[model samples]
Target: MTQVALTISAEADLIRVRQVLRARCQRVGLGLVDETKLITAGSELARNILTHAVGSRGGVRVEDVARSGRQGVKATFFDEGPGIPDVDQALVDGFSTSGSQGIGLPGSKRLVDEMTITTEVGSGTVVEIVKWRRDRSWRP
Candidate 1:
């Protein structure tokens, strides 16, 4: 169940993307706190796509997934920029290429149930995350 898919090309786009993620998550039974986490995580990833990717060229896709009897929301942020030179270092807290607090990557990870990163130095990056609904599990 792909709930939201859209292009994020600027700061303005980021706001809309986060709003959609929040609304979709809430509509799908995610509690307020869970919705905030999802939106926050999505915001960080989406911001990275804009800040690091070329021309802020990227897109976001959020979907509803029920796997292994667990229900969750999945969000993927992809960009065709100069890929992350060091995925490991980037994931480390306090590491920022753009010179900020550097909590975006690691903090986003903490907000989600699972996260995976795929990137190539000269190519691009794709970050996917999932947040499960612990109060209820999906059967079938």
Candidate 2:
């Protein structure tokens, strides 16, 4: 497994995060559409780190992963900020604590194959997302 880690300290870091994810997605044999989806989702999460976790320890880790003979890419966004109070409410499309469009979390979830959020009220939040390549030879 190959991994890349980067700090989310400024707006510039968001760009870097996207670039890293794009590269990893390609490395994992993801198609252009898959790459776009993963990169878009990554950008949203990186932005969340900057917008919601200002002055906190925030970072992103992207890596290549495989499961059941399938190749995929995974990105994990973490921050030591005021954790989410209500995860279900936060996932709602129109929900926002900072007066934004409130689509980051939900939109990202739709873009990835799997997404998981681990958060505590006062501790922090960690969101992990994965996108698997569609195998042409596999059928369910």
Candidate 3:
């Protein structure tokens, strides 16, 4: 496994986080479409870390993983800000507290293979997502 951490505290940090995720995904041999999906998901999540998790304090842990002969990229994010009060609503598409079309969490979920999130209303939030490598013969 290869891991890197990129801060998600500012708009500029979004670029860094996306860069790290893109690189990690490429290193894991993700295809063009997969790379786009991963970067898009990472962008949405990193943006949320800045917007929702007020004060824009948080970071994303990016990694290239190999387990049981399957390889993938994983992104784990954490923020010490007022967390989502309703995780369910947060996961629902078209739900947004900030009111900007509300597609981040749900959209990201569709782009990745697995996702898990934990949050506390007054404490913080954590989200982890993974996209596994696809078989070369059938990938497009």
By TM-score, the best candidate is 2
> Candidate 3 at residue 52, lDDT?
81
Per-residue C-alpha lDDT of model 3 across residues 4-121, encoded as one tens digit per residue: 9877877898889888888877777888888888889989998888888878469999887766677888999999989999999988989989978988999999999889999988
Best-performing candidate as measured by lDDT: 2
Model 2's lDDT to the true fold?
0.91
Clashes of 3: 0
| Runs in model 1 lying further than 4 Å from the true structure | 137-140
Question: Which ten residues in a row are the worst by lDDT in model 1?
Answer: 131-140
73 in model 2: Cα distance from truth in Å? 0.3
lDDT of each: 0.85, 0.91, 0.85
lDDT over C-alpha atoms for residue 120 of model 1: 88
